[model samples]
Target: MIPMRMPWRQGDVLDLASIGSRVDSLTDLSTIDGGPGARLTAVRTQAQAFRREFIETGTPDSVTTCDLVTLPYPTRFGLFRASRAIAPFLAITNRLLVIRWHESDGTPRVLLFEPSDVELGRYTPYFDKLAGRTPDVVSKRMVTEHATVLTHLARLRIDPSEVDYLMFDHLHTQDLRRWIGTTAPQPDLGEQPTPVFPRAKVIVQRDELAAMADLHPLQRPWYQPGTYRDVPPEAFLPIDGSVVLGPGVAVVKTPGHVFGNQSLVLNTATGVWVSSENVIAAECLTPEHSRMPGLARWAREWGQEVVLNANTIETTVDQYNSIVLEKTLADRSQRDSRFLQFFPSSELTASWTNPGTSPTFTHGAIAHH
Candidate 1:
């Protein structure tokens, strides 16, 4: 096994109990009338509040059920750098997730993580050029027919308007205005961009929003310009650190890939499920001695802390700490000693057929009870 350092003891559990209160303590950005400076102050204050609260409290109460629905988008294997042999040529699923859970009062809530709009051609550059635009069109059709987020929700009979929240682990090539609508006129339509989920609040880390507003040159290309510029402040639910969405659901800052990167933690029938893109596949979390290959093996050979999305690394130390915390949490939440069950928001295509994976969806269900 690759001798990796474990950040926490085998029996230690993550403290989550005060998360709801911490989230509630955050200043409502809509109420502040000042510019970005005021927003930044509020965000910093919120972060401090969360850290203080977490230090005082232990773990939160578990929820009854946490259901996940996978929505696959078209993308290339090279994005994950699995194996050089097939990486450049292979087509794979860029899976996103829709999480449904109940609050303390038993109110139903839906949260969409990394929901993509492939139909808008946002991911075309990631595909094989020789395959031409045909692959892009074909991939969109495949996802829409087999695993579009809306299609899966439709099958579950969940209305988009009923979705309570939307979030992303980090902002990379996301166009929120496409889903939540914009107040300004669209150049193409000369009208406001229509909201896909009219009632949902978009949750974003305060730091992440600040960075997007003034993105570095290197990070600019990965984001869709002006996407959030016209969004009303009321639609945003910004948090600084860990915050409980409900009894069993919470979003915790797991920064490394990006300063604002966070992970979704859920208490499910199976175990604790963390949905983030920090680790692209379950294989990355396996023990070093388990005979890994491709990206996992490369990581082992290079002594890299974790296999991460190439474009998002702000610092290696932060990423390493985040990965260790996630792994430790997953280990602590195991339903069985034989495995760990953390879910990656953008799931690997290999996970569907592979056993011993961190998060498998073959038996996943949208339980109503």
Candidate 2:
């Protein structure tokens, strides 16, 4: 049953025919096809075609978004121009997106996006420093409650071994050694951590790999390269460009937040949805409705579709264009038609403590059959 359910094989060639969705799912999608301009044009064209065929038509078995943890993040990072609304941080929840879809043959499959192992994640220097810098009014726990990806799997009745893929929007603050196991024993887990999702092939963008290998000074604090290095190479299934995983799902390259940033696009019972950390709040996409001070006005002034989560300015133009691509490829929210269905994988939530800094709109959880 397990082998029969797997849609991908270890050594199977990922040619267009084998990839199943008829979309370009290559490992070197970001190798600058003709140059950066050509690559952007090419990705945009593919995204529109992908949306028309996959996202606009089909439904996944279901896309259940479960809360893994909640923590505070910088306000400036959440919105491009937060103005005088709040100081320091706002509450954000990182969700584990459980995507269950099927191959054309009707074999069942599951993909876990952002199964963040919190313990390993703290190794990020910037995130680690946040613990000490947060005001005394903030709780030291970093999150109100915390749980592992496995705990959520149990609650959802998803067996760990059955998961087909494990992925993140980008590698920011992610430490995967625990999920896929490391090549050598280390102090972090006292030994090489045993694999949590044993059969899962981790999906990563090839460009993200390059970004990690040659980090710019600005990118260093956000990534813990040390934690990623020891993970066995076989554990990863790196793709270069946009590729549809199964019905209603494709990993689209949306670089800017990081050189290798990608967004998960899923077609659900309601409409098309794009998930990533490209923008932290729903208002960032639909700035017209934003109640947050200055956010809406800034977008109107600049004619921007979405205000970026500008933590790293490395590829600002590409990131902005990527957000537009995501917005273009998504359906308007079924809950609130005014907003696009761009779910921030780590969504910023409304909190009274962070006055004048709440999101204009919040789709608490995605609605799916």
Candidate 3:
């Protein structure tokens, strides 16, 4: 028989105080210190620097290509509360990106951002509680067609082992050990290190890895324990600052949704596309507009500078700064254009079709700028 799982208790792993101390010990890349005040200061100083560097670096001369694939996943209507008034009840997709570019030396590189291949059954408990619906209700809402990451890759005729790099915006409900493997057997999975992408390297912020070990009690629900315990140190490409992956692709330390959260920025023919889960939709960035909803609208009414995703409030000020930095980066990329075209990762799915209609899968290449 399968072993029964024990309920998580306060001391089952680590205490709240210890978690906070661990987070404090993690390296923070921003100029400002760890409090809300420093985060607010970072909103102006660090965000400006982030924007300036990307603009000054200029787009790579080599042809850069990108495409968005909407992977099927379980999502609640309430998650997109801002747009609930418009559509009421609807399903959404987990937007994933496939990026291809060449280095200065002309070596071909392939990167996958949030290659989510989650099993809904594994997360049924969280979905049931989050949507305040029964198991039956949740099951009916989940879209199963074209769900797995392998199927999408198969359609593209690309092999997972050929991938050069893999990244996630944060560690929320992710199990990278399955893909990258570990040095020893994982507690939950009694399996040795068996990497799915044999040659690929996983890139993550060092601060994020630290935060995962000792998460805030409130933030614990979104992470899986022992997920990274077995991952060999050499397999990880942990960064403390912005890292240029290729000529036109860079992973910038945004740090808002989580203490170690980061965003992927790519210079595309359309414009700079930022792959991030920090905000649910593009509307979150334009809080000044009246049509903006939820925390964004509230922020505008309260005369706040920016709005955030409202997932983790451990660092509210830092989240605000991260959002501002995203906006600045998008703005600088479009200085010559008449309007903005910053693509929120989710927008790729939500904007694909009208609400209540079946999803129409689409794909395209992001030509060189």
Task: Give a tens-digit lDDT track for model 2, residues 156-230.
Answer: 899998898888999899888878887779785788788888888878777777667767788888887777667
Residue 349 of candidate 1: its Cα lDDT? Answer: 49
Q: Indicate the residue-level lDDT of 101 in model 2.
A: 79
Regions of candidate 1 where Cα sits further than 4 Å from its true position: 1-19, 23-86, 89-92, 121-145, 287-305, 332-339, 350-369
lDDT of 1 by residue, 229-337 (tens): 5766667776667687665566877776777888876655554556677765554555342233354466667765345544545754555556655665553323334
The clash count for each model shown is 5, 6, 0
Between prediction 2 and prediction 3, which has the larger TM-score?
A: 2
| TM-scores for the candidates | 0.67, 0.88, 0.72
lDDT minimum window of 10 residues, candidate 3 = 18-27
lDDT by residue (tens digit), candidate 3, 1-369: 222221122232223221111112112545455776666555556555655555544464433223323323332222333332344333434555777666655776778787654652245334436545546554444433444666667876779878888888876766777677777786566568588888787677777766665666767666764455557666666666566666557787777678878887776655566657666545456544424224345655577744455545667666777776677666522432422344545442443223532222212223453
lDDT for 203 (candidate 1): 75
Which pairs of residues collide in candidate 2? 26-240, 27-239, 27-240, 28-240, 29-240, 29-241
**Each candidate's lDDT (Cα)?**
0.55, 0.77, 0.56
Model 2 misses residue 52 by how many Å? 1.1
Q: Quote the lDDT for 288 in model 2.
A: 80
